[model samples]
Structure formats: structure tokens, C-alpha cells
Target chain A: MTLALYVPRQSAVHRVPAGGKLLALAVLAVVLFAVPTLPVAAAGLLGVLLVGLGAARLPAASLARQARTVRWWLAGLFVFHALFSDLPTAAVTVLRLLALVLAAAVVTATTRVTEMVAVIEWLCAPLRVFGVRPARIGLVIAMALRFIPVLAERADRIREAQAARGGSARGLRGVRTTVTPLLVQLLQMAHTISEALDARGADDEPPARGRRSPVTAA
Target chain B: MKTKDLAYIALFAAIIAVLGTLPAVNIGPVPITAQTLGVMLAGGVLGARRGFLAVLLFLVLVAIGLPLLSSGAGGLAVFAGATAGYLYSWPVAAFVIGWLTERVWSRYTVVWGVLINVLGGMVVIYLIGVPVLAAVANLSLWEAIVSGAWPFLPGDAAKAFIAAAIADQVRRSYPVIERPQRELAGR
Candidate 1:
């Protein structure tokens, strides 16, 4: 659950707004797709390294680890292309992937989850026109994040109960038995949580005014 | 949405995340996961709008760097990869499944549920996902279909049946979806 890879550092990259970093990453993807040349891809890779290591002052290991994790996928992608296309095309594809992966790593490493979520809230602000409430969106997202572990724990309990019955929790039967109970439990819990929300005056509250999380209840 | 509506959607999103994190059912070398099944169940159980929003919220969490994807990978980088097509199709697929499920609510049976799941979860997913896979992975459409679409067909079919069965059970035990609100083609 501790999925945020943000490494606290004192650098200008850390100071850049999360929205800007996300926008840049998106533009980089479009650029790589549009150019589709080895030089541009290679330069993209180089620029990512420079910004990540030199300017951001992130450890080389951090970026290298991201690349290493995707090494097999990169190799397979290259091989797949080489088999169907040409060597240079494979090179560009792999390089393009590497650049995108590292660029994302750089952004993830530099920005906090809260900052990224704030950016998300800001982006969703325009969706308010369709009777969509941005504040409710934030609250629901936070609630989902908060409840994932609770549901996983409950799933474990259901599996254990099935195992106690000498039932296999591996095949389709296992899935049905396990998930149905899990889902039933979830619905019951949802009922309670909604009651809690009403009890706490959640409906009457204004959209969250700032970075404070709206979902304070467990 | 009411507080109950928000809770149901959020909880359904959590269920999808839980399914993604759980171990997959390995039929062969490839693992057949129930995360997609969760998508179908969300639509089947929650109806079109709420079901659509549940899956959308899950993706939003994924985009915001939660490790909710089956591969445990997250963040904006995944949006650029070859698998982006499948990722993009999820919310739409859920919506389609939910929309179909809502329409057939009056005559809803496990049989109808399976058909809706197959139409939305399998056919619709591949319809939108395969071409993007071909374009991004630089494979021919045939290659993409064979590699991207074929291996999962059997497993997905099985999942379709299972999802339909589970939805029927939920409908009987603790039905969350309301009666069909609109006529077919109304929305």
C-alpha cells in the first residue's frame, strides 16, 4: 500500500508543481510517438537522465532500478519488433519505452502523492459542469484508498474460513465462494459507512476547501 | 449522489483494487485474474452510472500512482505503454456492461448476465483494445488479436459465466442496483 515512490530531496525538480511535471510527461509521450526516430528517442533518454540525475539530483540507482524492473519487457519488446520490423525500429521502440519509464520515475520520485492528488482534483474541477462534484470525487477517492486494505483483510478472513471447510481457494469455486462473501461483507459495510457519513453531516459539508482529506472516518 | 451512493461506488472501487492485488488463477503460464471480473460485477451490481463511476474512480487512483494495476505498476507512464489500450478500455467496458445489465434488469438471469458480460467485458474490450495494441506494439492487427486477444478468450469466457453467476447471487441476496430507470436507448 505504501506505493508512493517519492524520494524527499532538496532540488528544483521537487519545487516544480506536480501538474507541470505531469503535463511534461504527457508532452514527452506525444513527442516520442510523433518523432519515432532513434536520435530523438536517444536524446529523450539522455535528457531524462540529465534532468533526473543532474538537475533533480536523484540517485542514479533510483532511475536505474526503474529501467531494470522493465528490462525483460524492454528486451521482449525489442525482440518482438526485430522479428516483425527492423533492428533500428526495435532500438527506437526500446529507447522510447526506456525514456518514458524513466521520465515517469523521475516525476514519481519528485512529487508526493498528496501533491499528485491535488493536481487531480484541480484537473477534475472542470467536470463540475456535468453535475459532477469535484469535492465528492476527492472524498470518494480517499475513501477507496482508505478501504482497500480493509477489504483485503476481509478477503483474507473469508479465504481462511473456506480453508477451514477443507475447500480449495484456488479455482473457480474458490473465487466464487471467496468473492461472494467478500462482496456481501462489503455491501453491509457500505451501508454502515453511509450511515456514518449521514451521522457526521458529510452531505451538508462544503467541498473540501484545501489539502485536508475529506474522508476522516474509518 | 447521496452518501450511500458515494459509499457504494467507493467500496466497489476498493473491491477492484483488492482483486488486482490477490493472486491470479493460473490456468497456464499466463495468470487469469479476476480484476476484470470485478469490473463486470461492478456494472452488474451497481448499474450503469454508478458502475461506470466505480471503474473510473479506480483508474483515477491508478493514474494518481496507486499500485492498483494487476502488475502492481501505476502512474502516468503506464498510460503511454502498449497496454494503454486495455487500460483505456476498462471504464468504457464497465459502462457498457452496466448499461446492458440495467436494461435487462427486468428479465435478468444468469444467462442474460453472461451475454452482457461477454459483449461488454470481452468483445467490447478487445474491440477497443486490439487496434491500439497493434498500433502501439507495431504488430499487425492479426498478430495483435492472436497474441493480445486469443489467449484470454477462454479464460475471459469462464470469467464471464462466473461474473454473471455472482451478479445473480448478489441480486438475490443484497441487490444494490435499482429497477431499470430508463428505457433502452433513452440515455
Candidate 2:
């Protein structure tokens, strides 16, 4: 069973409203883009990472688990940048990237998926005037959250099945084999879901019911 | 939320995190990740509201600094990178996917769902991502689309079809929790 990276801690950071966190993220994103100085960006990134570590109370093991997948990419980027760009610029760029990723992960790990939905609903409330239904919007958000892990698991299963059937997805060839099965499985899965929704009468509702929300309240 | 629902959310989130662990297709500008497949499934299965919520959950974790993206990419800085537009569009794409899927509820046909997924999810991503790519990467719109949006189209289409099929199967086999109104209406 694939485990969500959400740590489920009752930290103050977790309690912070999703809207506020989003706003902060936006501000930081702006800062990251606006600032041109490598030193300043690096410093900002470090500060963000420090705050994220403190807020999430992340353990060494969890942190390692999180970083395990990206290490190779990071290494590749470092080497590529080092060879191409000046060392200082590459270091700064890499650090900025790492800091941003860490900050977002902290938000996801600490906050409940439901709360995130609530926040999105709240954010989209303003679109109601344009005919958006917050309830429907919330439903969409909830489903997206739910499906992430499901598809992930299914992809893994398909890959394993293909491998068992003498498919050697060992390198580049393996990559192609893995992707093809995953796609095929996904197509098959979508057909099954559409039929189920039809049986459940999902299509009877009017499209106007899905109008954009107008109020963006906190 | 009920325990079951919570369990469902946890399960999906885990799926997303695991997908994040997989190797990404590093084409230029933006790498294709399996997480988008997760995003598409969220919409196909959960309808509009819940599907978008799920993407928000994934984004929140990314905001809080967890490396929950393909190639383990996360952090506030990612929001400024070339792929930010695509990453940011996940929630909206899910919403669009769900809304469209809900529109074509024709008895679990994978093709219909795949059509909706592509039209709603992938199209919306490009609509939002292309301009953002232009601005962030300092390229023209055409150049950005060619570089950022064009490369991912094939992979995204595959994901859309897959999500549609999975959703169809789930609907057929599983006993979904029906909304009270739908139950009352007996449709």
C-alpha cells in the first residue's frame, strides 16, 4: 500500500489557514522570481527551508524518504549546471529550487486533504456570481485528492504485471514498456469509471449548476 | 469527513507520492510526471468538487516544502520555475476534468471519459501553462508552446485515457457513496 507523505501532525503550521499559506507561497514565489541576486535568493531559500523544517517537525527518515526520489535529478542538475553555468549561479539556482520544493512539501505533509478542499471552496466562492457552484467545486477538489494515490498504485501494478510477463523494462526500453502498460491500464480504468457514473446518474444535472464561483472570502 | 473518506484521501495521496518517486521524462522546460495521471483520476472518479480538492491537497503539501512532485521537486521556488504553470493548473484541470466527465455520463465508456479528460485537463493545462511558460522562460508564446506544451501532449493524452478507463472500471465494480439527493431522486 502506498502511504501518503502527509505526516498528520497537529502543528501550529498545520492549523494555519490554507488561504494564508497560499498567500504566503505566492509572496515567496514572487520574491523568488523578483530577486536577481544569488546571495539574496540563497539566503531566502535557506530561511524558508529552516521554517519549513521547524513547522513540519520533519523527521530524518521522512525527509530522507522524500528526498530519495529526487536525489538523482538534483545531482544531474548540479552536474549539468556546474558544467554549463558558473558555479555560483548553478549553486544558487539549485538551492532556490530545493528550498521551494521543501516549502511546498511541508504544506502538503502537514495539512489535511479535506482542509485543502475547504480552502479551495472558500477561494472559489467568489466565482459564484459567474454561476460557479462551490459545492461542486469542492467535490472536484476532493476527487482529485483521492485519485492521486489510486492511479499511482495502479500504475505500479501494471508495471509489475508487464515485467512478470517477460517485459524487460530495464533501462530506456524498460521505461517505454512501463509507460505503455500504465497508459493502457489508465484507459481501461477510465472506461469503467464513466460507466459507473452513468449508472449513478451523474449526467442528469444541468451544466449551469457548475458556474464559476464569484466570492473569494477568507 | 468520514473515516472511509479519510482513508481514501490518504490512499490517493500516497499514490501521488509514490508516483512522484518514479523517473520523469525530462524533455526540455518541463518534465512529464505520473502525478498528472493521479490528477486526472481524481477528476474522473470524484466528480468536480472533490477532484479539485484532491489536487489542492497535493499542492498544499508541495507548498509546505515536501518533495512530493516528479523527480522529488517541491518548494515555493517551484512555483517560479518553468513547470509552475502546469503544477499550479492541477486543481483547475481536475475541476475541468470532473465537470466534463459529469457532462458525458454515458454508462462508463472509457472513450468519452478520455475525451473529456483531454479536452478539460490537458487543454486547460496548456491554456494556462503556455503563457506562464512564455513569461517565466522569456520565450515567445509560440516558442513556449513548442518547447513546454507540445512535448507533454502525447504523455498527457495517454494519462487522460488511462484515467478515464480506471474511473469507468471503478464505477462499474465498486459501490460508490451516492449523494443523498441522487439517492432520493432514484436516478
Candidate 3:
């Protein structure tokens, strides 16, 4: 079975504040890219992998699974450098990429979506002075997070339908065949949802703006 | 904005994320994914402001460490990568598409939608994505163009056609734009 990015567990990594974790990730990246040595990057990759699997208590295989997706790109980078530059440079570059990817995975696996949303809302509070509403923006993000899994399930069903009809195409044609119908269904769903929202007066702006207070009107 | 508008933005953002999950067709370093079609639809149907907001919301989520990007990658590191230009181009791309769609409302034909998607969604994004990718990947400009833009042209054309058709069908079936207040009051 394909491993999920997040594994729900009680661990220190999970307990760390989202902001702190994000900060650590940024610092790690700065160090890795600033010092582009093979040994340095290799060390960083080893430390990140170890922390993900050990400190975070993530399953070793699951952590490795994240690396599996980028193996091809790493291989390509290796070949590119090998042909143009040198093997040492190629090794350092791939390691650098892998370290960054693993570090990101660690953050995602540990942090909850809600926590991140909270941090985002807090950060965006300053925009209120500019007449921006952070709460509404936060709601949009929360809703998007909630619907991602639902839509992914819908896509699977669409692909299944295509396969049943023996109409599945490969490569770019496959994207066209799958995406067209998927967009239609999603847009239709959005239509229904918008109607529900409007019926509940979700689109209405309060008429209180620009109105005088009771004392002023008197 | 109304709750309906917020819902639309959130729904489109989710659509972008869901599109990312589909396996990418590897053309070169930058694989072709279905997410850009979502970007096109967001602009074509939602109008400019909401479309831009929807994409902005997606990008923010990507920045804050959501594994919503193609290939299950996310966080600030992505902003420093070869694809960084493409990542950063999404909002402007959506805005342009929506702006074009709104101005040409009288003639909101499939042709118009296709043109907007190509010019705004594909071309604008590539103009930014190619150079940034070249700089980060250390490739020459011509090599970057060959590797990044050339193979995707035909697929993007197909995407543009289908995105326009889908948007046209959506507009006909369900009116997304707000009606005049008098018309609403009469109803």
C-alpha cells in the first residue's frame, strides 16, 4: 500500500508548534543550500532521515517512501551532472534535493492542518488594517483542506468509469480524457454548493456599513 | 464577499489540490499535471477577483507545508526550487485569465476561453517558469525552453480547448456571475 504523508500519532514532532517546525525547516534549508558540499549535504540528508524516522517516530519505510517519488528526478540530475560536470557534484546536488524533500515531509507528517491554519490566520491579522478579512481567508483554506480527500475519491471513481468502458488513454491524452469529465462534475457540484450558500444568505453583505449610530441619528 | 463566493473560492482551491494527485506525465524535469486545468476553470467561471483569491489560497497552503503540490511535495523549499517560477506564476496567471473573461462577457465563447487559457494560463506561466527554472537548474535559456516549454505546447493546447469547453458548459448550465440588483429584486 502507498504510504500517506501524515501518520496520526502522539509524538514530540506532532506536539511541536507549527510555527517552530516551519522555522526549523527554513533554517535547515538555508544551511543545506548555503554550503553546497557533498559531505555537508549527505550529512544533512542522513540527519533529516534519521530525525524523521527516529525523533518523529515515523516508520522508516514510510519516510523512505517519500524519497521514492523523486528517485527519477534525482537520477536525471545525476546523469545530467555526470555528463556535464562531475560525479561528486551530481551526488551533492541529489543529496541536497533529497534532504530538503525529507525535511518537508517531516513537517507535513507532524503538523496538523488546523494548526497551520491558525498560524496563517495569526500572521494575516495585520492585513485587517488594509480592509482584508483574515477569518474569511482562513475559512476558505479550511474548506479546501476538507474537500481535498473528497475530490480525490471522486477522481478515482471517474477513472474507474473510464477503465470500465475501456476508454482509458495514456500520457497527455489520458489527462484530457479524465480531466474534461472531472471538471464538468466538479463545476456542477460547485453550482449546487453555491446555490445552497446563496439560499442561506451566505453572499449577503451586512447593510450596517456607512449607517449612522442610534445616538447620531437622533 | 458573500458566503457563496467564499465557497466558490474554497471549492476551486480544493479542485486544484485534487488535480495535483493524478499521476503526472513525465515530459522532462517538469511533468504535465491536471492542476493547470483547474487553474483555467477557476478563472473562467469565478471571475477575476475570486479566481485570483482561490489560487492565492492554494499557494499559501502550499507554502505553509501542505502536501498539496504535484508529487506530494510542499513547503517553503518548493519556492526555492527549479519549478519556483511556475509556482509563483499561478496567481498572476489566474488573474489575467479572469480579467480577460470578464471584459469579453458579451462574447464569452469557447474560443475566448481557449484564448485566455493559452495566453494567460499557459504562456504567462511559461514566460516566468522557464527562466527561473533555467537559472535554478543551471541550464541555458534555449535548453530550458526546449526542455520545459516545447513538449508541453500540444498538451496545453488540448487542455485549453477542453478547459474552455468545460467553462462554457458550466456558464450555460449555472450562472456564476451575479445578476443586477434590480433583476434580483424583481425575482
DockQ of prediction 1 = 0.40
lDDT tens digits, residue span A1-218, model 3: 12135678888888899899887877777677668899899999999987888888988777677787568766876787787789988898788878877887788778776776788788999998997776666666777776676677786777788789888765556545565556656656765776875787655553464697888788
Q: After superposition, how far is residue A38 of candidate 2 from its true place, in Å?
A: 5.2
* Residue B23 of model 2, lDDT score: 71
lDDT of each: 0.80, 0.67, 0.77
Which 10 successive residues of model 3 chain B have the least lDDT summed?
Answer: B175-184
lDDT score, candidate 1: 0.80
Higher-ranked by lDDT: 1 or 2: 1
DockQ (0 to 1) for model 3: 0.38
- Indicate which candidate wins on lDDT: 1
Q: What number of backbone clashes does candidate 1 have, counting pairs of residues 3 or more apart or in separate chains?
A: 0
Question: What tens-digit string does per-residue lDDT give for candidate 3 at B127-168?
Answer: 999999899999999999999899889888887887787777
Every candidate's DockQ is: 0.40, 0.12, 0.38
Write one digit per residue (lDDT tens) for candidate 1, span B4-57: 888999898988887776555433212357788888888999988898899989
Expressed as tens digits, the lDDT of each residue in A101-151 for candidate 1 is 788789888987677767878888999899777767777876786688687
Better of 1 and 3 by TM-score: 3
